[model samples]
Target: MIRGVRGATTINQNTEKEIIQRTEELLLKMIDANAIVAEDVAQVLISVTNDITACFPAKALRNLDGWDYVPVMCTKEIAVPDSLPSCIRVMMTVNTEVAQKDVNHIYLYAAQSLRPDLSKS
Candidate 1:
């Protein structure tokens, strides 16, 4: 079986360091929460909202984990009206036996507002 874990994070500033740190922090949480090991991950795709182009958030994770083995891709989020700015989002597809309800989905900072129900806010 395969499941997708969704997560998001925000940066207070548009600097490269802020982008990298916030992205790394959120991804680490997402991976830990869902018990996602390297072997289980099929692929990771990251998108940063239009306001963000300081860096590719996925690279931050790769650098943090020393992940020379994982495949990662990044793209710019679609520019929609009234969208949250400075946001980094990840969709990780993993091979897992866990049920969808048992999987953890992370939403942090302003992005949390989008999935308040899931976050139990």
Candidate 2:
């Protein structure tokens, strides 16, 4: 079955380095939490707040082993008033045996506030 794993993180700045580092961290965390391998991933959808125009968050995966062939789509997150700034969000579609309810969704840094209900207790 195809399942979705979501994650979001806040970058300290809009610079390429910060975006890449934070995005990579978020992806790694999701992968580790869900035991997701590249072969299991169908596609990755990423969205960033309008304020972050420095680089595409998906580009951070380019240097990761086994991620070169994975399909990734990046876009600007809808600009909402009072929304968290420098937030990068991702939704990865993966073919996995795990039940949907068992999947891990990670939210870190300021982005954690975006989904307080999903936060780890």
Alpha-carbon TM-score of each model against the true structure: 0.93, 0.96
lDDT by residue (tens digit), candidate 1, 1-121: 9999999888999888999898888888888898788777888999988888777777786775546677889999889998888889899899999999998999998889878887732
Candidate 2 yields a Cα-based lDDT of 0.91
Question: Which pairs clash in model 1?
Answer: none
Compared with the true structure, all predictions reach lDDT values of: 0.85, 0.91
- Number of backbone clashes in candidate 2: 0
Model 2 off-target regions past 4 Å? none
**Residue-wise lDDT of candidate 2 within 24-110, one digit each (tens)?**
999999999999999989999999989999888898888689999999999988888988888999999999999988888999998
Clash pairs, candidate 2, are none
